[model samples]
Target chain A: MNKYDKCVQYILNNQNHFYRIAYCYVKNEHDAQDVVQNTIIKALENINSLRSIGAIRTWFYRILVNESVNFINRNMKEIPYEQQSIFDTEYTTGFYQPDDELMQLVLSLPNDMRTIIILHVYEQLTLKECAAIARIPQSTAKTRYYAALRQLRTGMEDCNERK
Target chain B: MNENKDINFDKSRDAYNNMAIPSTLDDKVKEAINMSAGKKHTNNRIIITVASAAAAIVVLFIVSVNTSTAFAATLSDIPVIGNIVKVVTGRSFSEKNDNVTINVDIPQINVDSTSAPDTAHVTAEQVNAVIQKTVDDYMQEQQSVIDDYKKSFLETGGTIDEWNQRTIDLAARYEVKYQDDRYLSLYLYMYMSAFAFTQDNYYYNYDFVTGRELTLKDILGDDYINIANQSIIEQITEQVNSDSNAMYWGYHPAGYSGTDPFEDTDKFTTITDDTSFYLNADGNPVICFPKYSIAPGYMGVREFVIKRS
Candidate 1:
């Protein structure tokens, strides 16, 4: 099969995880669908540009990250500081159905930390791979991952205190 | 402490993986692939190149197609600062000899990856390609509309010179209002003055993690439509009654005989999806209705800022 066909097969097999990664950014069903669809289109078009077949996973994810960033930057707007805590409300109000308290802590992270943690811990990617997707240095990715851990620890402590 | 941290990490990892991926997504992907394959003409078509400067130091682009064109002037091999990424602003401007003008600016990503360098450039190139394609498609459609107008003008007995004398211009620019590791909001404003003055506004809000363009319903949840509609209606009524300049079509002086201000609420309710809104500097959603929708055409556009506590 051609590169496009190969890319399609890869996407089809890994679509569930792809959708989850997308869902983490968009937090909605339809928009996640749009992102995944658009990312696939983008990935197929640029498949020829890939330098190595071994790096396809990172390359595909880098596209996904870029698309997600573009989508958010394209749609960025202002919310009042008071209303900015909507993500918290989204989780607590049943808008975001986190499986448990740990999931809620994962969601509570600011976008940057949350992304790094998800990539390292959840996606099981190495710091090098996370850095590639994040378009940051490996050192920075390492820092962010550890920082996210600390934040989650603090969050868990606060939750337990409240109980 | 490290062991506890490791356990927490494992727990979070499992939680992350366990979240359900919609079963319909694979079907959607297959359908999208098929659909894209069907559209041969526009698929991966390099449409237009908006701008390219031959300067060695600064390379500026407003693109149509051709990824190679964007890289004409690349950033220095030496990465700038610690995490310095160059933001390549893609812009396209077309002014037909007849005074019909179209200007478009799209932000393109260019990163200098001093570390993990191989794929960063690749990702940047891909992003530039995708964004350029989107802008090109939008401009192509806009150009088609202008072409049709000129054709119809000739058929309707309007001389070429007369249409030329009309001096119609269209300008659209995309603004990156907010950017961070995970979120991006872009606002597009297009104004066209062909027959009468008209302007359109679009907001593309995205969550980078989810890779989705957010909408009002997504941000505000299910009850957003009713809540936002009521809030906007009340705000409009207050403004119309108190502020002399604020006037909806219902409150026009020429035919002020009898029209309830709430007469437009039914129409307002119709704005359930595809509602045009932008976030203010304070990050509040400000809903913008097109010209003549809620007010007189001359008033241009009407906007209501939704303040949520």
Candidate 2:
């Protein structure tokens, strides 16, 4: 198959990956779906720019992340933690039950640090890929990741003590 | 980390990991793909035709749009055109009661997709935070100044009424002097009195593809500092000697007698990596020097336009 066919097939098969990444930013199913759809269209339109098949995942992730950020910046206001719902339990089930307190703490972080945590801890990308996607230094990415984890740990301790 | 902490973190990650993709999404993407097959061809045609007319039309459109009340908010929303849109929009937090009056004009940077994908994703919050902090800091400093003046007035036997009558006016205005697909130059003007007026210029250039901020070294190689220094000194000398009325705060035996600031070839050693610069339309770097730095205050801010070989 040609590269276009391959890209389409890859996108089709990995719909969950795209939706989840988009959902992290929009925090809603419908908006996330719209973001994913826009990303797919943009990706397909600019598919010729994808230089190497090996770099397609990072390239695709870059587009997905950019689309997600753009969507959030355009549509969402600064919603306080009290107003933000950590999990939409209606859509997700089984072993994917979100830790509400931890998720809330994660969402409360500045966008840059939050993105690092999402890319590192949730998306399971390598440090190098996360840095490249974020357009930041590898050292900066590592620093933010550790800082986020530390913040999460402190948050967890507070929750446990309160309980 | 302990097992419990790991469990909680893992669960949070898994929550997003199992994001439910809508059953209809595949069909939608397929539809979009098929739709774009025709639209992409038409888009290319439009781009080709519009490319020439863009320069004239873009300026006209941006100037009109900048006057709109919601321009700042909407500018951040424009995506994928590769141009920088700037509009001065902010609520007047300026206070004018008794002691002093402060006027501030906050500016916002708008990124279209064509400029760089990285910057296009920059949120209104990120850019606004910078402007807000700058304005806030200036306000705080002025507040202290007013307080100090109030204390001194009362100490010198001036009445509260008399102190109240004394007023100092301070204003700050931000201007978007230059912008294109590659570079953006913002000038912030702070006015107190004629001698107290100051202008600061900020230049931002990004890699067209990555949208990452570029520095002088990135464009000018390892010896960028030396090269920039040499170019600026040569430009200054030419301007001071050749120009009739122009003068630098440097020595010329034929004219003004003072220590030659550029005599030491290490003239630009003080220019740090973070020195402000902006590119002109022809892509030449203009080194922006603050007022009273390289020349007398009468000369205003000095700019050295470097013509790279």
Candidate 3:
């Protein structure tokens, strides 16, 4: 099959993965879906720019991450006083909150470190591939992965002590 | 090393797997693919036509150069047309490892001065020297920051592995914003990302005709400050009204309580002589405020185009 067909198939197979990854950033159902939709459109439109089929997964993830970050940046401006209170309460009531303690700890990490953990541990991408997706150097990704794991270990110990 | 084995991600992985997939996702993917397929064909046709036209131009130019000595002489005489300045990466330095990443691209601006020599004030050599020195100084400052971060990280009971994992990135790059035979506008940005990201931007605007730096006054005349302030306030008010997420200092939304401490003191007032600005393609002055200057950092850079009245 042609590259376009192959790209379509890849997107079809990985749509759920894309949605979950985007959700990690936007923290809402609608915004996550928007990020995924935009990513799909961008990927399809720039498919010819994809130099090699072997690198499609990282290439697609790079677009998804950028779209997710851009969506967050655009919507990060100030809310009106009343609306800001409601926005705060929505988080307190746990909208899109992860159920598991480990997942919560993973999500609590800084944006860069959390992205590395999710891509490496959850998505099972190699540190190299994660670096490519996040557009960081390989060594940086490896370091971030370890640091995330260290944070998680510390978090788990604290949870155990509290229990 | 054994941390990976100690924590079981099975539950989190299960939660990820169990997350509900949107019901409309399949339809969305199929629709996008179909749309792309249609666009690809039209794009390919346009590319072909443009390529053929370019090819024709190349053939005509080659034939003229080979057959006509006068045409060749004219081409040699006029190396570049108008006030076009060429910017090239003069030097690049990159070092990447587990600890840090540094990538700096020093730009060299070459001005093609085919215009009248009498109108020139600042020579191209002076401009190039100033830019080179500014970039060199910025690189040194950033290098010191990285070194300080490394020192602090190591001193704070951080392991070598952890230190290595938190690789800092330092970069310096330049972009040409607007250019013409009369005026050239560009900026050099220095970025360092360690525990957090910080960027510094330096803007340079030169008027080749006057041979002096271009300023808001030069573009907007004697009443430059008032003109810029009025234009900026109107744009900000319009932006805040249109977008729910758009916010600026001093301007309150409908439900705002007028209680923000920064409302009175840190708000954007009139533009000073030192306000950052660059010319747009249409020659309008675009006043700029860096992140956290007028609005929150998330707003990135706030820019307002001051139309000539």
DockQ of each: 0.17, 0.16, 0.19
lDDT of 1 by residue, B1-309 (tens): 363444456655676778877666755675455444334213212221211111111122212112333232232232332244445566666666557766667676556566425444764566566556545555566568778988998999989877776666677677776655544566665556555333445455544333334567765667877778888878767775675444454442332333333245323444556466766666667787754455433234578887754
Best by TM-score: 3
Q: What's the C-alpha lDDT at position B76 in model 2? A: 43
Query: 2 or 3: which has the higher DockQ?
Result: 3
By descending lDDT, how would the candidates be arranged?
3, 1, 2
**What are the Cα lDDT values of the candidates?**
0.61, 0.60, 0.70
Writing each residue's lDDT as its tens digit, candidate 2 over A1-163 gives 3455567667766777887777677666677778887888798778756766678888888898899888766644554342334233432334232356677677667677888877777778899999988888999998888777777787878889999
Better of 1 and 3 by lDDT: 3
Best by DockQ: 3
Candidate numbers, best DockQ first, in rank order: 3, 1, 2
Question: How big is the positional error of residue B160 in model 1, measured in Å on the Cα after superposition?
Answer: 49
TM-score of each predicted structure versus truth: 0.41, 0.40, 0.48
What is the CAPRI rating of model 2's predicted complex? incorrect
Residue B171 miss distance in model 2 (angstroms): 2.3
* lDDT tens digits by residue: candidate 2, B1-309: 442355357667666665566665654554444444335434434433432232234234334334433533443454433445444565455877665777877776654445433533354335455556555665565566567867887999989987665556777677665565444555555554211122233343433232334567766778888888888777776775676335454433253422443334313344666466776666667777654345433345578777776
- CAPRI verdict (incorrect, acceptable, medium, high) for model 1: incorrect
Q: Determine which window of 10 residues in candidate 2 chain A has minimal summed lDDT.
A: A86-95
Chain A superposition TM-score per model = 0.87, 0.81, 0.86
* Candidate 2 clashing pairs, residues 3+ apart or interchain: B80-B113, B80-B114, B81-B113, B81-B114, B82-B114, B82-B115
